[model samples]
Target: MSLWGKTDSFTYIMNQTKNLGLAVNVISDYDRTNANEYIKRKNVLVIIPSLVENSPYTVYECLINNVNFLASNVGGIPELIPQEHHAEVLFIPTPVDLYGKIHYRLKNININQGLLNHKTILKKLGLSQLNEKTTGAFKKIDEANSPLVSVCITHFERHHLLQQALASIKSQTYQNIEVILVDDGSTTEDSHRYLNLIENDFNSRGWKIVRSSNNYLGAARNLAARHASGEYLMFMDDDNVAKPFEVETFVTAALNSGADVLTTPSDLIFGEEFPSPFRKMTHCWLPLGPDLNIASFSNCFGDANALIRKEVFEKVGGFTEDYGLGHEDWEFFAKISLQGYKLQIVPEPLFWYRVANSGMLLSGNKSKNNYRSFRPFMDENVKYNYAMGLIPSYLEKIQELESEVKSLAEHQWWSFCQ
Candidate 1:
């Protein structure tokens, strides 16, 4: 391996190697146009030792060639490798830590499968070929009267990410907005310190921060909702970042459509590189009909992307805390749909969903995703909804059939084992 350029760190690294008696090569004035082919031919892995970056395209070029890469996990560098591929990619925190890691990779590194996945991501992002959806314009609401919007954010920890999220909100084009931040019983000193700083700076402009005693997602969001003072309410996750035009675009859609729930599709962004903002997207959810039809409950549109009217919150009684962590958003959407509230989807990617390497979805945390652990709570909720006439009887029957199918599959496996 060689250092591609001349730098103080490179010089220091070279000097450090004097005791070990190893050869050092500094490739000067290397042409980037031929870098990929050069790297592929040499079967050499690219090492990016930058302390700060924002989703560099050089990493993708390496991916295109199936060449292994080592990057410091700063800025959006951690997002270069998808959450599923974190185990394979080297995400180091310090440059000195790369010494042992680089040697380990020389002996045991297979990146062909990662290359295939990278190709899939490129296709998914439509980066190879531009399309109409990526190029379309965001529709505007023609009214001049902008209503106040309460943006509710519920956070537990990860203060660094939350700071970015708050900055994104502060930079919104729609100025007639209020932010309600709820710190859900953060036990970390770092979180408390960050929240205290935010409280001093952003406590005005109808912004309020509440610190609760430890109540998880649903309750924390409910606390924020209760304190909100806007006609329209937007739920945001602490880890997610909103576009500058996000609030304006969604408000325009909501005002034009007069729908109870206005939502737009979210695009996945690794690190900090967001796609061209406020563009029409091909993957938006369209209603089956003009009204709240029965088919609306089949899929959960996710609460993070939703902008609901404050009245709708009062009618549906916010989210059901009894349902707990996993399916609370799904159940809330289902409940509101059953109550005959209209849902209108804004056909643009207004939100940037940060897919981190470790989270509830990808961390393989049994405490979060275990079906058996959640089955009883889900079953009781279904029965209660059916009893209260909030859900159709057919849904209850469908649940029973689904349970039967699961049991039959388990029994078949047991029989095979016998």
Candidate 2:
């Protein structure tokens, strides 16, 4: 009959309640203890009208005190309530329906009978009871004993896109995360200003910022890794956004599989002309089958879409700083494979990769130097593999000539001229 909270419809509510002969209590602010006691002793039904919620903790109190509850079944509220309590909790879709439910509950007509299955409720909320004790999976995720994930991000201008990437990490379902931001010498005044503002915002949210006087992706990332103090390190790009469940999904899969490195497919953002490698090559799961060649390394898992244990990085020695155009991830992962470390594919699109219509490589940097540097990196790696006997000499011979194969072809006119 009456409404609470700050509302502009006070006049309408007061007239309606008066006409219905019901007293409407209006309290602007009150003591927390008194309110809790009042809610426990007096309130017959608690109605939460908000259609959107992150997590409704008040519902927990209501359920614990054995009070009848009603709410709009939108956003995360429905998920918080147990499936068995669907009918009893009264997820009314409209004002008329809410009134009808209230009338039924008032008459004690057993409208919500047999709807409180606590076991199923706890399970839906990712909780359980072993023996007589309740176990909370959500609680365990934030405990100090849980593995802390270090998310390493490198930035060089593009303030337009960096905010989204940072926000994605903040929104992750996994809570034990420490963000390491390495600013690779932002040259522009606007970039510096924007980055300073962003730094202030995220510093309060638990992100560490490292500064560099020069621009190098490999070096910047290595610097960030040095500052990280987590059990695992997940590399991310400034241009990409991660899904909310990305970390949780990857961490769970990694723990279960017991792999030193984990990779996931990425969803492409902003360019239909370019297709994701995962979409094109669905069978590219790791533990790369018998293909210890140069080309295999070219198409291996990407660092932006992967998670590596900290020990693996320490063993292989972070990233190679020579190639700044960014082939370090492929080379690092390849070395791990050759060294007998296990790699597992999560087989899900966990992050977004930004692609433009023209220019630039997958890393979002457009430099002619990349083509020249990447070639030697690939060739020298193959040569090393051959010298180490990891790959056969015949394969090495084939790889060496791959770049000049077109020029070395025999001409058909030579026989006619002779």
Candidate 3:
């Protein structure tokens, strides 16, 4: 109705095609069932003008739906104009105001929801991005607590799985939490059905559904982060189940340790098989190590059960967007560890990270490729993991070779080939 800003911004929001974040993009979508060709684009920014607040879809797109960034001229918009970590809160007076939807507000210029001309920026401090796929596991929080907590679940093509994950949160002991579902480019009929379920069934529980760009997990999480209001934030996956006390435990731990990040082991179980050996490790938090060698620690990298203080997440600039599909958490952990943030890897198995057999090796390979791709940007984690997985095998092979050599030499004095 009120075309307050230039047409480009409105056109951008109105013409969004991908269903990547469609659930979150579509206001009140409960079933989360739909499919579309909406690609989660990057490098392009979105500016949600104050004028479109009257539009039914404005809050969904502006808040939950992922955008590189957003700039808004704030006022009385949607009753629930999605609030991220530091999207312009309470609204700004300036018409051309920028609210750094992905980042936070600075003393100088407010970052628009969309384009952030680095040159126009007085100082450019990169904000951390979040995983496109966050979880919606609910947990208890005290009423007097300083900051509220919100749990976000990001889903791509796994609508049925997403329901299981969200239901676990819905059934949590914690009632003070909210659930935000991120539809990461899953524009299918089934996905839309699930989105509708979330919006209609759980409205009283502060439930919200959103869409994210075709952008991978990092951006998806970042997109969810854009809409979260909790003083603290928690993550979960669509396919995994959460403990009744999952959120309660993490919040308690965060309160106890005063650290930015805290994690507990996720229970590893299969449909009908034994748990993988890697999932059986005994250790919890990554044993602290020097920067050069920490990447080599196999125990430190996985995200089966992990939590980070919201402040710590914002401080670390979130997950690296470059890692579209894999190794995003590894890089995130490495970066935060290097920054002297206190972390607690709780030994308790409080969550479930489903490493299903359907795509087990394939998942590992993709993660490995992402690790290799990101290895160049950071440290040589590839060599580190390779050496760890290989050196033992090489040693065993050498021992066998020595046994053969010894037996052959007994038969013939010069058995070098053996």
Candidate 4:
């Protein structure tokens, strides 16, 4: 048996397998060429004894290559396997359980049957259908008939990053787009110089730049929205680099679903790595759609970088312009949900979100007193439900406070106070 994985746990895994009297050829490093060659071998059974997993790509790879695999019945693994073959494909992740399954698969090696089942599984999951649907949608919407999307990008002295953001916009596959670059009172000489250089180019491209005096992100976005002429508005931060198909995919989804607001998944990039591949630095953030019970306390409504209908945005009164609170997106999304606006997720990572050590989010964390300022947007029922969700934590805190009070009462100074 050949073992292929990262070097971090190779030594430990080798030791454990050797102790079990299993003869294993360990290949610590993972390479596509080596993996492809290994999978092509006859009578090869891929073993995945993962204790925990979430939508492992190994299953997909095996299915696509028509290779059979025995995986642990954990997480989303079972969901990916065909129901009829679950008894043969899934194991308990224990040595004895894995050994039995391995022996069974080896004895009954039927590549033709496996290949047919794999194709059926892939089709059922809609993995094979996504590309066709996307291509069809793209062909249906031409430049003349496509709705104009006004991309509102807010900038605050990140001139160097702004260049990449603007470049991304220019490289978009969607041609019916207008750029609204809002400069929120940039004080740096470099910022002014860069803006001045791009002014003529921006004007020629029919883009507008709105200048404001340190109004923060919320106000800046709102100001841009006011100047926008498109039917749909897209919000983007100066630090974010959008994928080429970002706008196109969003527009198609909006038209198809008739959703009032749409948000896509994002891959996180640390610092100023503008255009990194998916998950090069960190995991992809798959933001969930708006749910009032969750959105009231958490920002489960995705990022501010979303495509929204202009009328819906206007109805929600735009983003809350609280100076440094840093949750205007959450508040705005929650408001939309409260008012019965249809919000949907595109289910694809179409942008790169830059994560820095210091930003509005960090500053906002320091000012927790203003965290609940968005409560005004929530109605009485929502507030009550949110409070109920906090009851467990509140009760724990109350117990601690009561213990402290009892300890103080037992002190010698307590009698003098009474």
Which of the predicted structures, 1 or 4, would earn the higher lDDT when compared with the native?
4
Which stretches of model 2 miss by more than 4 angstroms?
1-145, 271-297, 358-418
Q: Considering every candidate listed, which one attains the maximal lDDT?
A: 4
Please write out the lDDT profile of model 4 over residues 43-90, one tens digit for every residue: 678888899999888877786677767789999888777677788888
lDDT against the true structure, each candidate: 0.69, 0.67, 0.57, 0.81
Pairwise lDDT winner, candidates 2 and 3: 2
Q: Which run of 10 residues does model 1 get worst, by summed lDDT?
A: 368-377
- Model 4: worst 10 consecutive residues (lDDT sum): 365-374
The candidate 3 region of ten consecutive residues with least summed lDDT is 31-40
The CA lDDT at 186 in model 4 is 97
Task: Tell me the spans in candidate 3 whose CA falls farther than 4 Å from its real position.
Answer: 1-142, 272-294, 297-301, 360-418
Query: Deviation in angstroms for 134 in model 1?
Result: 24
Mind giving the per-residue lDDT tens digits that candidate 1 earns over 140-203?
Answer: 6445558889999988887888887888898898988899999988899999999888787775
- Sort the candidates on lDDT, descending order: 4, 1, 2, 3
Name the top TM-score candidate.
4
Task: Give the CA lDDT, 0 to 100, for residue 3 in model 2.
Answer: 40
- Per-model TM-score, in order, reads 0.51, 0.51, 0.50, 0.62
Backbone clash pairs for candidate 4 read none
